[model samples]
Target: MEVNEMAAEECKAVLEHASLGRLGCSYENQPYVVPIHFAYDGGYLYVFSTSGQKVKWMRANPKVCVQTDEAQNQSEWISVIVNGQYEELPGPQYTAERKHASSLLAKRSHWWLSALGERQMRVGDKLIEPLFFRIRIHSMSGLRFTDEKERRG
Candidate 1:
């Protein structure tokens, strides 16, 4: 198998079509990672989530990493890693940005359901306020792996 570095455009293409990623955050030297659904637009990755451990951790440390990938098999795969800062979109102050995120996320069916449902299950009927945030991408890198034989074929 051979691994090649993906260009910026190629990385962006993956993000555009990817709906799921792993979000990594650190607080006080402790690292935490979680799976999330996101939308990519205009150099940012938008996410809808509930107030939880990740929110608290990210609030303390804005620096984060997001990883997404597609694998066809052991010898073929594409993976992307993004290093960014987290920015929360709150009402009144970020009304416009929030609306934009909502619209972009709406393209995926039930995009908001996972976050809300998980919170509901944990809180037990209490009002679950959804939170919107975006990861301001600072840098991204990607790799593409292919089997040598497949490349020749």
Candidate 2:
């Protein structure tokens, strides 16, 4: 088996094809990681979630990281890591950006349904509110693992 560093374009390609990623945030030296569904454009990743621990932590420290990976088998895999800054798109000031995010996310059927359903079950309220946020990707890197014999000299 051999592991190789993926080029910038390769990393972006993986992000483009991926909709789910693990978001990592830190506050006061403590780390919290959560799985999130997101839409990737050129330099940003749009995400939706309710007001929770992750949000609180992100609000305090905008620095964040996102990880996404795909595996065909035990030995064949690609993993991407993105370091970014968190920015929440909210209210009237960010209407356009919010709409853009909604439009991109809408491409995936029922993207918002599960979040609302989870909120309803947890809060027992019919009026469910979810926030939209975007991560401003600063840099990204990736690694690919494969059988060495598959590549020719």
In TM-score terms, which candidate is top?
Answer: 1
Give the C-alpha miss distance for residue 148 in model 2, angstroms.
Answer: 4.6
How far residue 32's Cα lies from its native spot in candidate 1, in Å, is 0.3
Query: Which regions of candidate 1 fall more than 4 Å away from where they truly are?
Result: 109-128, 150-153
* lDDT winner: 1
Q: Global lDDT for candidate 1?
A: 0.90
RMSD of each: 2.4, 3.1
151 in model 1: Cα distance from truth in Å? 8.1
TM-score of 1: 0.89
Count of clashing residue pairs in every prediction: 0, 0
lDDT of 1 at 110: 72
User: What RMSD does model 1 have?
Assistant: 2.4
The sequence of per-residue lDDT tens digits that candidate 1 reaches over residues 31-121 is 9999988999999999988788899999999999999999987779999999999999986989999888888887863735665777688
Provide TM-scores for the models.
0.89, 0.88
